[model samples]
Target: MDYLLSIIIFFPALASIFIFMMDNNVAKPYGITISLIEFILVMVLWMGFDYSNPNMQFENTFALITTYGINYHIGIDGISLFLLILNAFIIFLGTIYLNQPNDKNHLVVCLLLLESILMGVFSSLNMVLFYIFWEISLIPILYMIGAWGTGEKIYAALKFFLYTFTSSVIMFIGILYFAYLFFITTGKWSFDVLDWYTLTLPFDIQIWLFLAFFVSIAVKIPIFPFHTWLPHAYGDAPTLGSVILSAVLLKMGTYALIRFSLPFFPDASFALVVPIAILALFMVIYGGMLAFAQTDMKQVIAYSSISHMGVAVIGTFALNLEGLGGSIFTMFGHGIISGALFMLVGMIYHRKKTRQISEFGGLAQIMPKYATMFGIVMMANVGLPLTIGFIGEFFSLLGFFKSHPILTLLAGTSIILSAIYMLILYKKVFLGSIQNIKNLTLKDLCPREMTVMISFVVVIIFFGIYPKPILIPIQNSTQQLLQIMNDRAIKENTKIHLQNSLNKQKTALDTLHIQKLLKEVQYA
Candidate 1:
């Protein structure tokens, strides 16, 4: 168990090298075995995790650059624990789905490497190490999309790389400047996020730094105007690529907003809430409309991702326990729901050799099992009650409503929009009489595909019914984060903002009956 975090972080990378050298015949089996082991390791970490403790656990630090004070520091709190598990779980399923004979060993290698890099991203406490992992993650994904993707794959890959990388460079500049400020304030050098949190920055400086970080995070979240690359990337990338991109990669931006932006620049976050909320509300309605307009199945899911992520963004900036917790939970919910949807679409494409919604009809007649699975996932996507998706959206809207009621009303439109588009998609794809000759003979879910779908359904429903286990830890962490933001606010206005938000958050929690649940969990 010693260095458990390090081992979990590096094992996939080491395994990728070995799998790369594997013969094409055994490569998939070896890759699956390796990924499964990694998943198990992550589950072990989760099992042993101290959910009641909000601070970082299993920390390991080493001075990688002594003079610059950039150490190889890593740890995880409740906020990061499930994200790590999610990364591992999704990669395991992705590897299993990539069982096509033509799936080269290198593809598996790229996936494993991406897993390792993302693991580091969620766990690293040092900003320098986090950035290193963050930047390196682009390589495998770029190669995956460019080499194995569909139409305009190379163009999509390049656009994705350019947009994300360019914005990241701006963030790096912010990181360096922020570090310099840290040195100036303390007469020492450090890129540790914990250390940086101790510094009380001027409101003016915080605004500049917040923008520097926000650009990169927004582009990754693909918020509004910056989201142009996503449809192409999702539409053209291979199914596995789409799954990973939607499920894990997109969350990176929202997660960073929670991990860095709110805490690092509380004043800026409080000051900019209205504008950010406006953009988020716009994305919610806009992405939903675009999703409704899509002909291609992949593109529909891609646009829906943008819409759902907007909710997460709103929750994050709500700057309270209900909003932050809901945002984090929504990230997980969206990951599972969206990934399942892409997988179902990929299965259809595999049989029909097309993703155009018009090409197929009455799929339920030919592929009842597949249709059923898709229906469940689609319902979750729509945020139907008692599904995993509902919990996050309900809390996110509730939390944000406390901060901005009118904006939350606009944001709530996403729920109706999502239901309309998703049900339309289901009806078009599965309800009508079979029209195409090819569709009449299409096969249903096979055993392998059934296994994956079943797993997704089980998790979705299980968590939906009883989310307290996850919610408790998330609330614990968000409480600590809010405390930090509250404690670090230098401006009187910022202090008042934090206090008002906290009061509203407390009221929301009480109304939702979550405070009772939290106290019970704590007593137990």
Candidate 2:
């Protein structure tokens, strides 16, 4: 079991390198087979996972560079396990949906490499190790987008690289700063996150560190203001790139927010709750409204991403069991549903060579299979009941309602707005009359595409209706985290109250000193 985790993490890289060396003819088939093997390994890991344990499992450690106390440390708990599963499943599904039938060896290798890096990022326990995988993960994705994507792919790729790279550099400094502080106090240097967790830094230090960390995670989550790169990236990316980006990569930000930021800077995090929540609210309403106005199918999903992620951020900041749990659940649901949406758009664009909403109408009559799948995915995107989307959203709103009822009310409007625009999209694309001659001959979903779409819908309904499978493990993970935050909040507040009391006593003494000084002057 110790090496079981390492096998899961490293096997994809091995397979990728193998595929890279293979001929293009062989690479495509071999890559898909390798990915399936990897997926099976993940499934085995899932079955073996002891859900009762909230702590990291399948833990493995090897000294990579022990001089600085850095090790190749990796493990997973409930919080990351599902993400790992999502990463493998999406890549496998994306592999099956490759655009070109020409078997591009390099592209196959890049996708395989991406799976490796994503796995490493999820399983990494050491901060430096995590950071290394973190930075490496972007490179293959950059290549994936630039090489295969349409319409200004290079620009989108560079934007993604720059946004992530710049943010990561700041985060690196913060990591160094914390490690240095720990060294100064304890005569040791380490980049283990769990090690850094114990250092009680001053409030000022936590604030700066929090911002540095926030910049990196925020850029990935692209939480408002910083989210400008996402639409262009997601819109221009190839179907595989778009699916991977939405399904797995973006969640890295939300995951890191839980693993690193919130726990490390509890005081600063608490101070930030209101402002972040307000920003999240703006994302919900603004993103939804922008999505509503979009004519391009890809752009609609891109903006809708912003809207959905806004709710994720709100749920995250709520800082309670339901909120945190829902945020994680939402992350999982968003990955599955958004991936399907993008893939569906890609299918249409593949056949019709156009994504304009006006270009599509009455597709249902011509392509009932595609329309059926499309309708299911669209409704799921809009958070329909008995689907995965509803559970995450329902819980997130429920959680937010506890803290800020008014903001929750505003966030709830996204529900209405999303349904309106998404349904309008479905009607325009699939229903009505075939207004254009070209639309009459459109093909239904192919076997491979049909399989992928059905898989997504099934997972959506499965998790949506019975979320306990996901929720139970997450509950164990988040409960421990919430308790930690609660304890930290209590301790910090108590310390502040005591400090204020002492300041009041000092003020009384100062007043007495001034009065005594005046009496001495009068006596003289």
Candidate 3:
């Protein structure tokens, strides 16, 4: 298990080199085998993980640049463990489900490269190493979209690149400045996040640095106005690309919010909570309305992602165990739900050569099994109980309600909006009588497709019913993060203010009988 983290990070890239030399016919199976091994390796890491320990485990550091105090430092805690597994799992499924006809081997290579880069992004503790991994990730995704994508593929790819890269450059400047601050204080240089966490700046400096990091994270999270790039990117990318993009890539933003923003700028985070919550609530309602208006099936899912991620962001800024825990849970839940939905859309596209919602109806009459699976996933998308989606959304809203009740109420409307749009989509696509003969000839899920759908269903329902295993570790880490924020808060007033909010929330929950109900659910 020595160097297990590094091995998990680099295995895919090294495997890609060998697979790249093979012909398309054999490359896919070889790639799948490699990805499967990677997945297993991640699971092994999980098996050996110390769940009760909130500190970073599997840590490995090697000095990379002594003069700057940068190193090849990496580790994983509860926050990152599942995301790493998610990256490995999604890419493995994506490789199995891949169906590109041209340059298939190259596409497979791109996926493998993405897997490696993303693994690094999740595990690296050094700011420089994390940034390097963060920037390199854009390349494979760009190639995937431009090379194998649909209409306006090149345009979508370029827009995605410019938006993310330009904003990330700003974040890099922040990182360098942060390191400089550390050096000035300690008389040495360091880009280690753990080191930065212990270095406190004045409120004014914190505000500037927070803004510097927020702009980049917001764009990546694709919050509200910055979200325009997403629809274009998702719409044009191939199925596998869309799957990985929605599943694992977008999370990098929200993850950074927890990993870097909050701990690094506690005073600024406390000061900015209201405005950020406003933006998050606005994103929730606006994205939902836009999704309701989309005629294209894929576009609906794309817009919905904006709304769902908004929920995660709100939970993040809630700045408590419940909120942070719910946010991480939401991230994992949305990843699985959204990725499955995109795959379903891709399946329909492959058969009908179209994604127009009005193009086909009475799909259930022709493809009962696909309809059944789609129905289950659609229910989960709307946060139906006993489905994975409901757990995260419920806890997220509950968490934020404690902090900003009115805003949480507005945010809760997204649940209704999501139900409306998703149900409408299901009714439009699957509930009608066979009107188009073209649809009558469509087949149900094949063995390969069935495997993917079943896997999604099992995970969705299994985790929904029994989420404590995941929730416990997430809460453990979030609690540690909250301690960091508390200990680092520059102003005594900021600490007291946030503590009072949490106390009032606890009292309100107890008075309303909500606490009792939650305990029942937890034990159930």
Top candidate, metric lDDT: 1
lDDT of 2: 0.83
RMSD of each: 2.8, 12.2, 2.5
Candidates' C-alpha lDDT: 0.90, 0.83, 0.89
lDDT of 3 by residue, 1-524 (tens): 76999999999999899876788898789888999999999999999998879899999999988999889999999999989988988988888888777678999899999999999999999999999999999999999999989999999999999999999999999999999899899999999999998998999999999999999999999787788899999999998888888999999999999999999999999899889988888789999999999999999999999999999999998887678878998999999999999999999999999999899788998999999999999899998877889878888888788768999999998889999999999999998787688787888999999998998999999988877778867866877887788778889977885566446544553323433545466557
User: Which window of ten consecutive residues has the lowest lDDT sum in model 3?
Assistant: 508-517
Per-residue lDDT of candidate 1, residues 1-524 (tens digit): 75999999999899888765668878777888989999999999988988779898989999999899999999999899989988998999988888555756889899899999999999999999999999998999999999889999999999999999999999999999999999999999999989988888999999999999999999999898889999989999989999999999998999899999999999999999999988998789999999999999889999999999999999988888778998999999999999999999999988888999999888898899999999999999999777899888878887899868989999999999999999999999898898788677788898989999998999998888778878878887888888889999987887886787667556655424774553343345
Model 3: lDDT equals 0.89
Candidate 1 lDDT trough over 10 residues, lowest sum: 515-524
Relative to the true structure, candidate 2 reaches a TM of: 0.92
Ranking by TM-score: 1, 3, 2
